[model samples]
Target chain A: MNIDMIRASAARAEGHVRRTPLLNSHFLDEIAGRRVWIKPECLQHTGSFKFRGAWSALSSLNPEARAKGVIAYSSGNHAQGVALASKMHGAPAVIIMPKDSPRLKIANTRAYGAEVVLYDRAGESREEIGAKLAEERGLTLIKPYDEPQVIAGQGTTGLEIAQQAAEAGIENADVIVCCGGGGLTSGIALALEAEAPSFRVRPAEPEGFDDAARSLAQGKIVGNARPLGSICDAIVTPQPGDLTYPIMQRLAGPGLVVSDDEALQAMAQAFNRLKLVAEPGGAVALAAALFRGDEIEGDDVIVTISGGNVDAEMFERALQTRG
Target chain B: MNIDMIRASAARAEGHVRRTPLLNSHFLDEIAGRRVWIKPECLQHTGSFKFRGAWSALSSLNPEARAKGVIAYSSGNHAQGVALASKMHGAPAVIIMPKDSPRLKIANTRAYGAEVVLYDRAGESREEIGAKLAEERGLTLIKPYDEPQVIAGQGTTGLEIAQQAAEAGIENADVIVCCGGGGLTSGIALALEAEAPSFRVRPAEPEGFDDAARSLAQGKIVGNARPLGSICDAIVTPQPGDLTYPIMQRLAGPGLVVSDDEALQAMAQAFNRLKLVAEPGGAVALAAALFRGDEIEGDDVIVTISGGNVDAEMFERALQTRG
Candidate 1:
């Protein structure tokens, strides 16, 4: 929630988090008509920036609480993040996931040493299952996005961007982020506001699931009509988090939206140019930087490829897109 | 080349060369049955570590000679590396390549502002064409390997490994590298010998093109029967280099070789576990580390993915391999 909290999170997460390099390509610069810098969080442990938040939250727990265990409800990136974090901490974890989730994700989460409990997405409520389990086991529940420590953990990425941008001689530019419920977006906005005031955060989302953009435009939280169908399944929250919306409204620039095709093209370009595997959701910010350059200003732009946990079939489709 | 020359090259290439991170995955560690650390030079500029040698050679040139121009004969990663280095230095580059080279490589080299001169690999001598062009245009011919400056440049990767190993508390381990003409292998050997003598260097090559291994076993340089056709085209050299062979004999351990299928499987594993795109040639060391672990000793092993310039078709094939 504050710079001090983020710094403390950084202190706690040191040695655990990978300091992902700031990647760039001349080809990407030409496409954006400006210098394009990429922060590849996809290379982070658990293959996403979510590890930062997960570690932050887990590390902040009191010894007794941490010893008891933790529980989370996610079938995707968050599940893997929390599972790995808990495993590293030697704490047991129970993850509530939809039975219909991708087998790869389910296997990956279990491989990280988490006990996965499956529920019917249409019939059983994940929250009810998670709450009952947590209460019975005396386990602490780790929310995916709308948590103070988690936000602080995600903010560590912004700190790295500030340092990396300085190393690249970039003083001012827009920092585009792939937004879901706004954990990463608001966290980065807060970090940059304190560390690099000249830089602004801009949320990027898939067209139909652009609740963050609409929320920012309306100066209030807005909900998407449908969030489950976007190709960018990694980032398809129905609305902005109450804790994150105000921070983003106050500290971020306007949000940007791109189509699924644009995200796929960005993924192809990332694969061909940067040699980084970026999932559809991860490529949205990069998609905006490449194809929606006119909406952004300044000579330099920094975008994050937030995650890379795509199935081979979807990655093949992304690779087949025009680069 | 000695460690001092490598240190000098690192100094000259500072700011221009990327300090690629040492990436690791728990999954990869489990498969290798040891802690596996990956130095992804594939994420380096121009999609390979060749950029290090290219930039080092270019930056070491006298102002007049550098301004005159440069030329290189390669149809793969080396071509793109030299092209981009020359362009960055504001020097003209004339790249002589085989007409049958992949269209992506040719186009990518040209996109870096180099003049691509296509020749028949079967009938004509690229050396004669390159010599003629260099003489006519006062262009310096930059050899792919066997040059002291280029070897020193590649040695910088070892210097980094030495430092990174210290940070990781790794004092003794086998440092595996993808080997072609032994430039990278010898360079790294020399660097580790001087900087971290406890660490050993091992060269990894494709099975049929395992001349480096055969050379080391025979106590002399040996040539492969055929090198023109291999899935690992990037590292399919006829034999070890004259300059590099002696260094490898003195400083490196025994070489390891992996089959094409093993390399493909390694690439697929990298995509799944590390989110890194690795070409077959680049994945050889990793392949050896994972599939050939019985031959290697130690609780920790470090492998380098030397490049990521594989074509989309090849990448798709790699993705299809069983994880």
Candidate 2:
């Protein structure tokens, strides 16, 4: 939660991760009655903010662990991020993904030069398989959200936003970030709380996966009432992680939920007007800002577009939904 | 053209025009046997490089001219650019478009606060009608191309690329730009010919509208032998303009052409791999790099994506073509 540690992590991971631009959202601004700014992590290498955490975590590994390579279990952005980051560090990576994971994500991870091992979500426990692989291979397991270095690495995005907003002459802007396991929201909240104390950090959750919001209200982690169902595949985790829940509780301003239709509409608007191909998960923050504008408080709002790994079919459908 | 004047125009239009990003093309680079960089002007304001030209042209107008408003004739990107730019400058704009122009473009221009005046391309002369309207309304006519200020504005893109390349440690990258009325190529050539003299500036022309290529070789402006036919609607100009042709004669390197299929494939690839929504014309340079790799000389080749204002139906069809 220290700003200095987060800054150091940012400096350490400089060339490894891209400083994705904070672009102005003209259409969103007009619709929401506020000046909208987008932090396009969708443009980040590996097509998500996960790379920041993966690189930070991997880079902090000891020589012995590094020599043994790394293993991760993720069906989406985190998989690609680990694959690419591990390759950059000259360590082999093996990603365990659900058999039903999108072919695009699988292809992208393979393209990044990683070995993809698919398992049935219904029949197998990915964590167990990942741990078994790590144990047998004498490799390190880089958890997507739980690790301290990973959280700190993700915090750098908030640090960059604070710096970028200041440079853009924005003194205090509300930040709406999509939440799933809460790694990104927690990291961003921690960073903002330390540096830009006046800035409000809100967690935008998909309708069924409102654990973070529930947890915040109860002052503890909360499990989903039912399995998640949404086109926003990336942020459908069952619950927030132990490491991220406390941080979200401490700094998260308010939690909001957006429907699948809202996410799709936001995705279409982003593609047409901003010319940015945001995945459904990436567009959730924007969806909340546009569809639930009354819940937000501020003239200047910054939303995090967390990834851009959507396939053609999905994009076409999203656009159709908008029409 | 004076390099200082171009530089000054670049400085004047700096904040008004976006400094579009130069994207890495991993798939094209592998296929082309070299590194490929894509300058994504498709992501520019109003979804085209025309924004640069329009903003530059409109901003340079005298107070009296500004008060009188402006008129432009274009079927695609130019119309949208002029509409948006004129609105930004507080000058009313009237756009003369073919009655059959894509409904999306017509709607976009209207949404940008421009008056849409449709004409039948087969019957009435658009220029004559546009000029008459300008004369009657006391509005200034803003030609889409064949104008110094418009060329200077487009030159700002080249200036940005040259500066960006230098910063990336690329001293002599090959730059491939799509050519229509030759305004973009001429302006880019003028900028690179002076700023990055060692770099080769190649013009990518659609197979049907090779007027710029033919004109360059014959040492004069040349008309297409047949009517232009290409999916790349934005660059289907039948002839090169007098102003742009001479500039192309003085500054352009060899011009290259690609088939309709090739352009479609490039557009699909841009959407799939780069997560960029590029219109057909915007993808022509990429198509050239993918299909005509042997003709290009350097290990580093930069392709300019001219615009991203395609009809949604057409985009869906193009994506389906890949299937």
Candidate 3:
């Protein structure tokens, strides 16, 4: 969780991943009641910021372990991230996914040349399956957000934000991020604290799965009541990771939460105003920015849209849904 | 249309308009069956490249004319562009719009503080109305694409493409643009011919409204038999503009056309892969690059997504329809 570690990871990812642009819109500025800058990681490889972490983890592995390959468990973004990362490194990968996950996610993970193992989300533990597969196949396990290397890798996004904002003459602003396992939030928090100390990362989450918000407020780890039914499937984690909480607790601000309807509205706004396709989970931070504008300080605000791997029917439903 | 005029327009538009980013994706390259670079003017001010031309035209007005205000006619994008540009210059504006234009476009145009006058697309000539209003009110007329300053302003998009592509190590590309009065196409053609001599601009149009394509092939201005009924309403011009034609006829490559369904497919693919919101007309060039891969020359191609001001229902239909 140091600046040097994050800088090293960014260097490794420079030529490997897409250097996504930082977007700005006067339309978005009016919506959030401030100068708004959007960092659309929805354009990232694998359509999410997860690929950065995946690549970091893969790069940190020993040659022997890399030769043996890796195993990862994720319902969507992380699975595709690891799959693509492994392919880039010429390593085989096994992705443990939920049987009920979106068909598009599953198909994409496989298309990236990963072996897919489907397990019932409610009846089976993906952790158990991943551990067994790793042990049996002599493969390394790449945790989605808990690993130090992965966190450092994800921190590159914060570095980009700092550089881009400075280039655009933004002195400082609150950087809001969509929170899932708190990995992205914590990573950005650490990076911004080191690179742009005046800024803070505010975690954004769905109403029912606001564990990160509760955890930050209470100054401890908190778990969700239920995570199965949230339409923001990409960010419905059970709780924040142990490794990630300390960074978030120290460097992050009060977390923000928006209802599913609000997220839908944000997605539509992103599509219409920013012309960026953001999934529900991806739109949560934007929803918080637009809905919770009063809590935000300064005239400029930066929000990162984290993913866009939405199903066709679900996106249509979101388009039809009103806040 | 000369280099100096485009450079002057770029200078005037430096701070007043957005310098849109050039977007690239390996996923899009795979779809086009070649190296693909996207210059997304969809993220431009007012959500389209029209604002560039509008700002250029408004900036070129004499101080007296600027104070006297301006009048323009457009189906949608140009109306918003003019309204915003006029507001920026403290020039009052009157926009003559068709009654059948999207409600969102009309509302946005008015929101920019312009007076709107609706007329029938079938029975009324917007040009005549605009001229009459200009004559009566002592307001300067801003023809959408026939004006030299407007074309120079639109050519900024081409200048940006050339600079960004060169930075990305692309020496030359066949640049495809969504065509409407041949303004965008001709503007880019002039810029690329001067700045990136090896490259050429290619106009993209809807299935039936391939006026620019016909004009290029015939070496004369060719009008569409009927232009009112196309899904790509933003780019359904009756014929190439008088001033814009010769530039397109000389500097543009053989033009490209796509059906409504193919444009929808391109829109869907843009959302799914590129994570950009592209209206039907804006998606035509990408559609041509995707569906007509064999017809396109070289392994590298550049496509401009001209706008993203689609209505919600239209976007929903695009996401749902499969070619």
Most accurate candidate by DockQ = 1
Clashes of 1: 0
- In model 2, the Cα lDDT at residue A215 comes to 86
Per-residue accuracy of model 1 over B163-242 as CA lDDT, tens digit each = 88889888668899999988889888888998899887999999889999999999998999985788999998889999
Clashing pairs in 2: none
Q: For each candidate, give its TM-score against the true structure.
A: 0.99, 0.94, 0.93
Q: Scoring model 2 with DockQ, what do you get?
A: 0.57
**lDDT tens digits, residues B80-154, model 2?**
889989998999999999999878778878988999999998999998998899999898888888888899889
Q: Best-fitting candidate, measured by lDDT? A: 1
Q: Using TM-score as the measure, name the better of candidate 1 and candidate 3.
A: 1
What DockQ would candidate 1 receive versus the native complex?
0.93
**Candidate 1's TM-score:** 0.99
lDDT of 1: 0.92
**Each model's backbone clash number:** 0, 0, 0
Candidate 2 chain A, which ten residues in sequence have the lowest lDDT sum? A19-28
> Residue-wise lDDT of candidate 3 within B73-144, one digit each (tens)?
875889889999999999999999889877877888888889999999799988888878898889988888
Instruction: Indicate whether candidate 1 or candidate 2 has the larger DockQ.
Output: 1
TM-score of chain B of 1: 0.98
The C-alpha stretches of model 1 lying farther than 4 A from their native spots are: none
CAPRI quality level assigned to candidate 2 from its DockQ score: medium
